[model samples]
Target: MAGSSQKDRKKVGVFVQHECPLNLLPREIWSSIAVMVASNSIEDLFNMQATCKEFLGAASSDAVYKHATMSYKPLAHFLLHLDGPERRFLDRCVEVGNVDAILRHGFVEYLRFGRRDKGMELLARASTEGNVEAGYLCAMLLMFDHEDEEEVKRGVQMMEVIRISRKLESCSKFFRGVFNDAIVLLLEMFASE
Candidate 1:
């Protein structure tokens, strides 16, 4: 009886390994699911990746990173102080053209670190990708800081587009606060000069 039970257990294990429903799903389906998970919370995405090799592969998809909604607080901390996995995750998101990541990184680089040119490049990329906050910041920076007349004209056009679209009215309070802070910082920067 014991020997037969052991044999049955072996068969069950084999069946479980070979017939897992999740394993049967296509990679594209897994990637789509990962994107949904990532859109909700990046922490949940990390937990999903820890589940199994297949999930890990799915969570690593560029679509997942691109669509992931990284919250502002943790992302800000990650940007100010580089940690191991968090930094890598941020880098991957930026590499995959995550708009929020690009915008925040650009803002820090431009305002905090004083790498204006690189920051502007990143901000422009994010704005072109349809990030409203990035568009606002880029417009402000170009209008206020650039010496070139054409650059100022371009910034005016961007601001005009944003105003006509009524995007400012739709902006979250958090983003509005950020815009206010940016204006103050720009004022301080010029005042100190």
Candidate 2:
């Protein structure tokens, strides 16, 4: 029994050493080690990412989900309902670019605080593109409406700039108008300060 216990201890030591070897190791190997660790605390998870690119990439899976969870409970909970492939695709988004990451994190702000016109325009575009996932949210927003909420109402008015752009016949002109309006609005807001 003692001999068997010794073997088990040695096996555990080998696994630990293999994961976080003291000797200089290749980047890929080091990253693989980082992934093997199970972290329960958010602080430890972030610390692991800061350790190296391999760790960052390895933790990207947890990081993306964690970021979403911290930013929006509903969005995170909704994502959990997705099948395996969609979840895998989201992990890929974490690796490919920050755009998806930022959008996911900013979803609540867009939903609750963005100007009504801007939010509606964005939803219309999403609908036109056949984004079925956005359907439920689009319907809910229209039903509840931001006008009833003070903070959201402010965002709705600020977003009226979107309407001015919609008057143009050309799609390009419309976008250009939005860009110009954004710049002007920023300058005016800054000047007021």
Candidate 3:
């Protein structure tokens, strides 16, 4: 046979590599494997997402986001730039009880602190959904003593505005240490009267 052209050689290489180890697996099996492999390492999980569009779709999913917190900064940037569906995905992640997803990607503390009105705007939407834990999250962010009174007041108002009972209960249960500050503040307010 004549010597293969460089283009032909490249084509052969591509054909030989066509069936990536991931693509050959069934969808459900692939999802399971991705979940197992992505268990602890956020970077590996991110690289896995780059392997292919299918993998990326699966990896960016709530199951993966919950485990890896994959959608944080970029998701925030999307919102800042007005990237709608991407922002909505972050919203869904929060709605689905994805704490890691929210803390990992959604809440940009510095941005929130600097632009209090806009941050509260997003939190207000989250709160109206009755996302009580989200309410407490805003409250807790303000609980930091270093925050100014305006920020603290916004956080307290968020707690009062959140109508979700279950999340309120969860806030009281999971974050007792943080909740204590609110109680103390209320007591102090009463005592001063």
Identify the candidate with maximal TM-score: 1
lDDT of 1 by residue, 114-169 (tens): 99999999999999999987888898889999999999999899988988888866
In model 1, where is the ten-residue run with the lowest total lDDT? 72-81
Clashing pairs in 1: none
Model 3 CA lDDT for position 91: 59
Candidate 2 similarity to native, TM-score: 0.30
Candidate 2 achieves a global lDDT of 0.44
How badly does each model clash, as a count of residue pairs? 0, 3, 1
Q: Write model 2 residue lDDT over 1-193, tens digit each, in one string.
A: 9888887874444343365553356655644444344223334546777786666776656434423222222244322233464445344543444333333323323644655565555544443444333333344455456455764554344344333545223433533543465566657667989
Candidate 1, superposed: residue stretches over 4 Å from native: 1-17, 71-82, 145-150, 172-174, 179-193
State the local distance difference test value for candidate 3.
0.55
